[model samples]
Target chain A: IAGITQAPTSQILAAGRRMTLRCTQDMRHNAMYWYRQDLGLGLRLIHYSNTAGTTGKGEVPDGYSVSRANTDDFPLTLASAVPSQTSVYFCASSRGTGELFFGEGSRLTVL
Target chain B: GESVGLHLPTLSVQEGDNSIINCAYSNSASDYFIWYKQESGKGPQFIIDIRSNMDKRQGQRVTVLLNKTVKHLSLQIAATQPGDSAVYFCAERATDSWGKFQFGAGTQVVVTP
Candidate 1:
Protein backbone atom coordinates (compact mmCIF):
# COMPACT_ATOMS: atom_id res chain seq x y z
CA ILE A 1 0.00 0.00 0.00
CA ALA A 2 3.04 2.24 0.27
CA GLY A 3 1.84 3.54 3.63
CA ILE A 4 4.70 6.02 3.88
CA THR A 5 7.53 6.83 1.48
CA GLN A 6 10.79 8.62 2.28
CA ALA A 7 13.27 9.99 -0.21
CA PRO A 8 17.06 9.70 -0.23
CA THR A 9 17.38 6.44 1.65
CA SER A 10 20.93 7.41 2.67
CA GLN A 11 23.10 10.49 2.35
CA ILE A 12 26.40 11.95 3.52
CA LEU A 13 26.78 15.68 3.88
CA ALA A 14 29.57 18.05 4.91
CA ALA A 15 29.14 19.91 8.14
CA GLY A 16 27.26 23.21 7.93
CA ARG A 17 25.42 22.14 4.79
CA ARG A 18 21.71 22.23 4.36
CA MET A 19 19.57 19.14 3.76
CA THR A 20 15.95 18.19 3.57
CA LEU A 21 14.32 14.85 4.22
CA ARG A 22 11.11 14.28 2.38
CA CYS A 23 8.13 12.21 3.49
CA THR A 24 4.75 11.37 2.02
CA GLN A 25 1.85 9.30 3.22
CA ASP A 26 -0.97 7.88 1.14
CA MET A 27 -3.04 6.85 4.12
CA ARG A 28 -4.48 10.39 4.31
CA HIS A 29 -3.71 10.59 8.01
CA ASN A 30 -4.39 13.79 9.88
CA ALA A 31 -1.20 13.80 11.94
CA MET A 32 2.43 13.52 10.94
CA TYR A 33 5.77 13.55 12.82
CA TRP A 34 9.52 13.65 12.41
CA TYR A 35 11.83 11.75 14.72
CA ARG A 36 15.53 11.04 14.85
CA GLN A 37 17.04 7.79 16.10
CA ASP A 38 20.52 7.53 17.48
CA LEU A 39 22.36 4.60 18.92
CA GLY A 40 21.25 3.82 22.47
CA LEU A 41 19.12 6.98 22.48
CA GLY A 42 16.04 5.62 20.75
CA LEU A 43 13.63 7.94 18.96
CA ARG A 44 13.38 11.65 19.79
CA LEU A 45 10.69 13.81 18.28
CA ILE A 46 12.01 16.62 16.13
CA HIS A 47 8.80 18.20 14.93
CA TYR A 48 5.17 17.31 14.36
CA SER A 49 2.01 18.52 12.67
CA ASN A 50 -1.49 17.79 13.83
CA THR A 51 -2.90 18.63 10.43
CA ALA A 52 -2.29 20.73 7.39
CA GLY A 53 -0.97 24.24 8.09
CA THR A 54 -0.37 23.40 11.74
CA THR A 55 2.99 22.60 13.29
CA GLY A 56 4.53 22.16 16.71
CA LYS A 57 7.95 21.78 18.31
CA GLY A 58 8.86 18.50 19.89
CA GLU A 59 11.42 17.39 22.48
CA VAL A 60 14.48 17.99 20.26
CA PRO A 61 13.39 20.59 17.71
CA ASP A 62 16.48 22.72 17.58
CA GLY A 63 18.38 23.10 14.28
CA TYR A 64 15.52 21.45 12.44
CA SER A 65 12.23 22.56 11.03
CA VAL A 66 9.13 21.00 9.47
CA SER A 67 6.18 22.18 7.43
CA ARG A 68 2.87 20.53 6.66
CA ALA A 69 1.38 22.60 3.88
CA ASN A 70 -0.83 19.69 2.82
CA THR A 71 -1.96 16.36 4.16
CA ASP A 72 0.12 14.26 1.79
CA ASP A 73 3.60 15.62 2.48
CA PHE A 74 5.75 16.75 5.40
CA PRO A 75 9.39 17.64 5.03
CA LEU A 76 12.14 18.07 7.65
CA THR A 77 14.89 20.59 6.94
CA LEU A 78 18.29 20.93 8.54
CA ALA A 79 19.47 24.48 7.95
CA SER A 80 23.02 23.97 9.11
CA ALA A 81 23.68 20.33 9.71
CA VAL A 82 26.38 19.39 12.18
CA PRO A 83 28.37 16.22 12.77
CA SER A 84 26.21 15.38 15.70
CA GLN A 85 23.22 15.40 13.40
CA THR A 86 24.40 12.17 11.90
CA SER A 87 21.57 9.85 12.67
CA VAL A 88 18.62 8.04 11.14
CA TYR A 89 15.53 10.12 10.54
CA PHE A 90 12.04 8.62 10.59
CA CYS A 91 8.69 9.95 9.44
CA ALA A 92 5.46 8.77 10.98
CA SER A 93 1.73 9.33 10.67
CA SER A 94 -1.43 8.35 12.51
CA ARG A 95 -5.15 8.81 11.98
CA GLY A 96 -5.59 10.75 15.20
CA THR A 97 -4.34 8.61 18.04
CA GLY A 98 -3.03 5.15 18.81
CA GLU A 99 -0.31 3.36 16.84
CA LEU A 100 1.95 5.18 14.38
CA PHE A 101 3.00 4.02 10.93
CA PHE A 102 6.69 4.76 10.31
CA GLY A 103 8.66 5.03 7.11
CA GLU A 104 11.68 2.89 6.33
CA GLY A 105 13.93 5.79 7.47
CA SER A 106 16.51 8.16 6.00
CA ARG A 107 20.07 7.67 7.17
CA LEU A 108 22.10 10.87 7.19
CA THR A 109 25.76 11.23 8.07
CA VAL A 110 27.35 14.62 8.56
CA LEU A 111 31.10 14.64 8.14
CA GLY B 1 9.94 15.88 32.42
CA GLU B 2 7.93 12.72 32.05
CA SER B 3 9.60 9.99 30.06
CA VAL B 4 9.53 6.29 29.23
CA GLY B 5 12.42 3.97 29.98
CA LEU B 6 13.37 0.32 29.66
CA HIS B 7 14.75 -1.92 32.36
CA LEU B 8 17.30 -3.66 30.17
CA PRO B 9 19.49 -2.55 27.28
CA THR B 10 19.83 -5.99 25.72
CA LEU B 11 18.51 -9.49 26.07
CA SER B 12 19.46 -12.86 24.61
CA VAL B 13 17.04 -15.73 24.37
CA GLN B 14 17.06 -19.23 22.97
CA GLU B 15 14.76 -20.01 20.09
CA GLY B 16 11.36 -21.48 21.10
CA ASP B 17 11.71 -19.93 24.57
CA ASN B 18 9.51 -17.23 25.91
CA SER B 19 10.96 -13.72 26.11
CA ILE B 20 9.97 -10.81 28.25
CA ILE B 21 10.89 -7.14 27.91
CA ASN B 22 10.10 -4.55 30.54
CA CYS B 23 9.36 -0.82 30.43
CA ALA B 24 8.43 1.91 32.89
CA TYR B 25 6.86 5.33 32.44
CA SER B 26 7.07 8.35 34.73
CA ASN B 27 3.85 10.03 33.68
CA SER B 28 0.79 8.82 35.50
CA ALA B 29 -1.40 10.62 33.01
CA SER B 30 -0.25 8.48 30.11
CA ASP B 31 -3.20 6.44 28.93
CA TYR B 32 -1.84 4.71 25.85
CA PHE B 33 1.23 2.49 25.62
CA ILE B 34 2.70 0.76 22.55
CA TRP B 35 5.51 -1.59 21.69
CA TYR B 36 7.50 -1.30 18.42
CA LYS B 37 10.03 -3.56 16.80
CA GLN B 38 12.86 -2.08 14.70
CA GLU B 39 15.15 -4.07 12.50
CA SER B 40 18.76 -3.24 11.61
CA GLY B 41 18.10 -0.39 9.17
CA LYS B 42 14.35 0.05 9.28
CA GLY B 43 12.10 2.26 11.29
CA PRO B 44 10.18 1.00 14.29
CA GLN B 45 7.16 -1.20 13.48
CA PHE B 46 4.13 -1.44 15.71
CA ILE B 47 3.80 -4.67 17.66
CA ILE B 48 1.10 -4.28 20.29
CA ASP B 49 -0.49 -1.61 22.47
CA ILE B 50 -2.42 -1.32 25.75
CA ARG B 51 -4.56 1.41 27.25
CA SER B 52 -4.85 2.58 30.86
CA ASN B 53 -8.25 0.97 31.24
CA MET B 54 -6.86 -2.45 30.47
CA ASP B 55 -4.24 -4.48 32.29
CA LYS B 56 -3.36 -6.85 29.45
CA ARG B 57 -3.75 -7.23 25.69
CA GLN B 58 -2.78 -10.07 23.44
CA GLY B 59 -1.98 -10.29 19.70
CA GLN B 60 -0.94 -13.27 17.66
CA ARG B 61 2.01 -14.59 19.63
CA VAL B 62 2.66 -11.41 21.58
CA THR B 63 1.13 -10.14 24.80
CA VAL B 64 1.32 -6.73 26.47
CA LEU B 65 0.77 -6.27 30.19
CA LEU B 66 0.22 -2.98 31.93
CA ASN B 67 0.32 -2.11 35.63
CA LYS B 68 -0.90 1.40 36.25
CA THR B 69 -0.26 1.34 39.98
CA VAL B 70 3.41 0.75 39.48
CA LYS B 71 3.65 2.54 36.12
CA HIS B 72 5.13 -0.58 34.62
CA LEU B 73 4.57 -2.25 31.22
CA SER B 74 5.83 -5.45 29.72
CA LEU B 75 5.78 -7.38 26.40
CA GLN B 76 5.93 -11.14 26.35
CA ILE B 77 6.66 -13.16 23.22
CA ALA B 78 5.78 -16.81 23.25
CA ALA B 79 7.83 -19.35 21.30
CA THR B 80 10.38 -16.76 20.32
CA GLN B 81 11.95 -17.26 16.92
CA PRO B 82 15.11 -15.92 15.27
CA GLY B 83 12.97 -13.47 13.33
CA ASP B 84 11.91 -11.95 16.65
CA SER B 85 15.44 -10.62 17.16
CA ALA B 86 15.23 -6.85 16.95
CA VAL B 87 15.22 -3.67 18.99
CA TYR B 88 12.01 -3.18 20.93
CA PHE B 89 10.79 0.20 22.22
CA CYS B 90 8.00 1.22 24.51
CA ALA B 91 6.09 4.42 23.78
CA GLU B 92 3.59 6.34 25.85
CA ARG B 93 1.02 8.96 24.96
CA ALA B 94 -0.42 11.39 27.45
CA THR B 95 -4.14 11.30 27.95
CA ASP B 96 -4.56 14.91 26.90
CA SER B 97 -2.35 14.75 23.85
CA TRP B 98 -3.60 13.72 20.45
CA GLY B 99 -0.62 12.04 18.83
CA LYS B 100 2.48 13.04 20.77
CA PHE B 101 4.44 10.06 22.00
CA GLN B 102 7.39 9.64 24.33
CA PHE B 103 9.63 6.67 23.60
CA GLY B 104 12.03 4.65 25.73
CA ALA B 105 15.67 3.93 24.95
CA GLY B 106 14.68 0.44 23.67
CA THR B 107 15.90 -3.10 24.33
CA GLN B 108 17.73 -5.25 21.81
CA VAL B 109 16.65 -8.87 21.64
CA VAL B 110 18.91 -11.53 20.19
CA VAL B 111 17.45 -14.97 19.62
CA THR B 112 19.92 -17.77 19.24
CA PRO B 113 18.97 -20.75 17.12
Candidate 2:
Protein backbone atom coordinates (compact mmCIF):
# COMPACT_ATOMS: atom_id res chain seq x y z
CA ILE A 1 0.00 0.00 0.00
CA ALA A 2 3.01 2.23 0.07
CA GLY A 3 2.04 3.57 3.46
CA ILE A 4 5.09 5.81 3.57
CA THR A 5 8.11 6.44 1.32
CA GLN A 6 11.38 8.33 1.76
CA ALA A 7 13.72 9.39 -0.99
CA PRO A 8 17.50 9.16 -1.29
CA THR A 9 17.77 5.91 0.66
CA SER A 10 21.32 6.93 1.60
CA GLN A 11 23.49 9.97 1.07
CA ILE A 12 26.92 11.34 1.91
CA LEU A 13 27.30 15.08 2.22
CA ALA A 14 30.25 17.37 2.81
CA ALA A 15 30.27 19.33 6.03
CA GLY A 16 28.45 22.67 5.90
CA ARG A 17 26.40 21.61 2.89
CA ARG A 18 22.63 21.81 2.78
CA MET A 19 20.42 18.77 2.27
CA THR A 20 16.78 17.89 2.37
CA LEU A 21 15.20 14.53 3.13
CA ARG A 22 11.86 13.79 1.54
CA CYS A 23 8.89 12.06 3.13
CA THR A 24 5.44 11.28 1.78
CA GLN A 25 2.39 9.29 2.76
CA ASP A 26 -0.66 8.14 0.82
CA MET A 27 -2.85 7.38 3.83
CA ARG A 28 -4.02 10.99 4.05
CA HIS A 29 -2.76 11.23 7.59
CA ASN A 30 -2.92 14.60 9.27
CA ALA A 31 0.22 14.25 11.36
CA MET A 32 3.79 13.81 10.13
CA TYR A 33 7.07 13.52 12.03
CA TRP A 34 10.85 13.49 11.57
CA TYR A 35 13.22 11.57 13.83
CA ARG A 36 16.88 10.59 13.86
CA GLN A 37 18.38 7.35 15.20
CA ASP A 38 21.92 7.13 16.48
CA LEU A 39 23.90 4.16 17.71
CA GLY A 40 23.01 3.14 21.26
CA LEU A 41 20.34 5.83 21.32
CA GLY A 42 16.62 5.89 20.82
CA LEU A 43 14.89 7.75 18.05
CA ARG A 44 14.80 11.45 18.86
CA LEU A 45 12.22 13.73 17.39
CA ILE A 46 13.55 16.46 15.17
CA HIS A 47 10.43 18.26 13.98
CA TYR A 48 6.78 17.41 13.57
CA SER A 49 3.69 18.77 11.85
CA ASN A 50 0.25 18.18 13.22
CA THR A 51 -1.25 19.35 10.00
CA ALA A 52 -0.41 21.06 6.80
CA GLY A 53 1.31 24.43 7.20
CA THR A 54 1.83 23.83 10.89
CA THR A 55 5.11 22.73 12.47
CA GLY A 56 6.53 22.32 15.96
CA LYS A 57 9.98 21.82 17.46
CA GLY A 58 10.67 18.45 19.02
CA GLU A 59 13.16 17.10 21.56
CA VAL A 60 16.15 17.70 19.28
CA PRO A 61 15.34 20.34 16.72
CA ASP A 62 18.32 22.62 16.95
CA GLY A 63 20.01 21.76 13.65
CA TYR A 64 16.98 20.67 11.65
CA SER A 65 13.86 22.17 10.15
CA VAL A 66 10.69 20.68 8.67
CA SER A 67 7.91 21.95 6.46
CA ARG A 68 4.54 20.41 5.77
CA ALA A 69 3.13 22.20 2.77
CA ASN A 70 0.35 19.65 2.47
CA THR A 71 -0.97 16.50 4.05
CA ASP A 72 0.89 14.22 1.67
CA ASP A 73 4.38 15.60 2.06
CA PHE A 74 6.76 16.65 4.82
CA PRO A 75 10.37 17.54 4.18
CA LEU A 76 13.25 17.93 6.64
CA THR A 77 16.17 20.20 5.85
CA LEU A 78 19.67 20.45 7.25
CA ALA A 79 21.06 23.94 6.68
CA SER A 80 24.61 23.07 7.57
CA ALA A 81 25.29 19.40 7.90
CA VAL A 82 27.91 18.39 10.46
CA PRO A 83 29.50 15.13 11.55
CA SER A 84 27.21 14.99 14.54
CA GLN A 85 24.24 15.01 12.16
CA THR A 86 25.29 11.74 10.60
CA SER A 87 22.56 9.31 11.57
CA VAL A 88 19.64 7.36 10.26
CA TYR A 89 16.62 9.59 9.65
CA PHE A 90 13.09 8.29 9.76
CA CYS A 91 9.76 9.75 8.68
CA ALA A 92 6.43 8.84 10.18
CA SER A 93 2.75 9.67 9.79
CA SER A 94 -0.43 8.92 11.66
CA ARG A 95 -4.12 9.35 11.15
CA GLY A 96 -5.64 11.62 13.83
CA THR A 97 -4.71 9.54 16.90
CA GLY A 98 -3.81 6.05 15.76
CA GLU A 99 -0.51 4.22 15.62
CA LEU A 100 2.21 5.86 13.61
CA PHE A 101 3.41 4.39 10.30
CA PHE A 102 7.09 4.87 9.57
CA GLY A 103 8.99 5.09 6.35
CA GLU A 104 11.90 2.83 5.45
CA GLY A 105 14.52 5.47 6.49
CA SER A 106 17.22 7.67 5.04
CA ARG A 107 20.82 7.07 6.06
CA LEU A 108 22.75 10.35 6.14
CA THR A 109 26.53 10.51 6.48
CA VAL A 110 28.20 13.87 6.90
CA LEU A 111 31.91 14.03 6.22
CA GLY B 1 12.22 17.02 29.09
CA GLU B 2 10.55 13.74 29.99
CA SER B 3 12.67 10.63 29.59
CA VAL B 4 11.96 7.03 28.73
CA GLY B 5 14.68 4.41 29.00
CA LEU B 6 15.18 0.67 28.80
CA HIS B 7 16.62 -1.20 31.74
CA LEU B 8 18.67 -3.57 29.61
CA PRO B 9 20.62 -2.77 26.49
CA THR B 10 20.75 -6.34 25.24
CA LEU B 11 19.00 -9.63 25.83
CA SER B 12 19.71 -13.14 24.63
CA VAL B 13 17.20 -15.97 24.63
CA GLN B 14 17.00 -19.45 23.21
CA GLU B 15 14.50 -20.27 20.51
CA GLY B 16 11.06 -21.48 21.63
CA ASP B 17 11.45 -19.68 24.96
CA ASN B 18 9.69 -16.56 26.12
CA SER B 19 11.60 -13.28 26.36
CA ILE B 20 10.74 -10.15 28.27
CA ILE B 21 12.06 -6.64 27.63
CA ASN B 22 11.55 -3.87 30.14
CA CYS B 23 11.18 -0.10 29.78
CA ALA B 24 10.78 2.66 32.34
CA TYR B 25 9.18 6.00 31.64
CA SER B 26 9.43 9.19 33.71
CA ASN B 27 6.31 10.98 32.52
CA SER B 28 3.36 10.21 34.73
CA ALA B 29 0.99 12.05 32.43
CA SER B 30 1.71 9.85 29.48
CA ASP B 31 -1.54 8.16 28.49
CA TYR B 32 -0.52 5.94 25.60
CA PHE B 33 2.47 3.62 25.28
CA ILE B 34 3.59 1.57 22.29
CA TRP B 35 6.22 -1.03 21.51
CA TYR B 36 8.08 -1.09 18.23
CA LYS B 37 10.52 -3.56 16.67
CA GLN B 38 13.31 -2.48 14.38
CA GLU B 39 15.44 -4.77 12.26
CA SER B 40 19.03 -4.19 11.29
CA GLY B 41 18.44 -1.42 8.73
CA LYS B 42 14.76 -0.61 8.84
CA GLY B 43 12.37 1.76 10.49
CA PRO B 44 10.61 0.88 13.71
CA GLN B 45 7.51 -1.26 13.26
CA PHE B 46 4.59 -1.33 15.66
CA ILE B 47 4.30 -4.48 17.75
CA ILE B 48 1.77 -3.80 20.49
CA ASP B 49 0.34 -0.89 22.46
CA ILE B 50 -1.38 -0.15 25.77
CA ARG B 51 -3.13 2.87 27.17
CA SER B 52 -2.99 4.31 30.67
CA ASN B 53 -6.49 3.09 31.31
CA MET B 54 -5.44 -0.51 30.76
CA ASP B 55 -2.71 -2.53 32.41
CA LYS B 56 -2.16 -5.13 29.73
CA ARG B 57 -2.70 -5.69 26.05
CA GLN B 58 -1.93 -8.66 23.82
CA GLY B 59 -1.49 -9.10 20.10
CA GLN B 60 -0.53 -12.19 18.18
CA ARG B 61 2.24 -13.79 20.27
CA VAL B 62 3.22 -10.52 21.93
CA THR B 63 1.87 -8.95 25.12
CA VAL B 64 2.43 -5.53 26.66
CA LEU B 65 2.15 -4.78 30.35
CA LEU B 66 1.91 -1.33 31.85
CA ASN B 67 2.45 -0.48 35.49
CA LYS B 68 1.50 3.13 35.98
CA THR B 69 2.34 3.17 39.67
CA VAL B 70 5.93 2.36 38.89
CA LYS B 71 5.87 3.92 35.45
CA HIS B 72 7.21 0.67 34.05
CA LEU B 73 6.34 -1.02 30.76
CA SER B 74 7.27 -4.40 29.40
CA LEU B 75 6.86 -6.43 26.24
CA GLN B 76 6.74 -10.21 26.34
CA ILE B 77 7.25 -12.31 23.28
CA ALA B 78 6.11 -15.91 23.44
CA ALA B 79 7.89 -18.71 21.62
CA THR B 80 10.80 -16.53 20.59
CA GLN B 81 11.99 -17.24 17.09
CA PRO B 82 15.01 -16.13 15.11
CA GLY B 83 12.85 -13.65 13.26
CA ASP B 84 11.95 -12.03 16.55
CA SER B 85 15.55 -11.06 17.14
CA ALA B 86 15.71 -7.33 16.76
CA VAL B 87 15.83 -4.07 18.68
CA TYR B 88 12.70 -3.16 20.65
CA PHE B 89 11.74 0.34 21.75
CA CYS B 90 9.02 1.79 23.92
CA ALA B 91 7.38 5.09 23.04
CA GLU B 92 4.93 7.26 24.89
CA ARG B 93 2.45 9.78 23.57
CA ALA B 94 0.85 12.31 25.80
CA THR B 95 -2.93 12.36 25.94
CA ASP B 96 -3.29 15.98 24.86
CA SER B 97 -0.34 16.23 22.52
CA TRP B 98 -0.63 15.64 18.82
CA GLY B 99 2.05 13.87 16.83
CA LYS B 100 4.49 13.98 19.72
CA PHE B 101 6.11 10.70 20.70
CA GLN B 102 8.98 10.15 23.14
CA PHE B 103 11.09 7.04 22.59
CA GLY B 104 13.20 5.12 25.09
CA ALA B 105 16.58 3.58 24.45
CA GLY B 106 16.08 0.24 22.73
CA THR B 107 16.84 -3.30 23.91
CA GLN B 108 18.38 -5.62 21.36
CA VAL B 109 17.11 -9.20 21.41
CA VAL B 110 19.20 -12.07 20.15
CA VAL B 111 17.63 -15.48 19.64
CA THR B 112 19.90 -18.51 19.64
CA PRO B 113 18.72 -21.56 17.84
lDDT of 2 by residue, A1-111 (tens): 769999889999999999999998999999999999987678998898888999999889998988888999999999999999999999999988878899999999999
Stretch of 10 with least lDDT, candidate 2 chain B: B2-11
Superposed model 2: Cα runs more than 4 Å off: B1-8
User: Which pairs clash (backbone N, Cα, C closer than 3 Å) in model 2?
Assistant: none
Q: What is the lDDT of candidate 1?
A: 0.94
Model 1 lDDT per residue over A1-109, tens place: 7699998899999999999999999999999999999777778999999999999999999999999999999999999999989999999999998699999999999
Each model's lDDT: 0.94, 0.92
On lDDT, the leading prediction is 1
**Ten residues in a row with the worst lDDT in model 1 chain B?**
B2-11
> What does fnat come to for each candidate?
0.72, 0.62
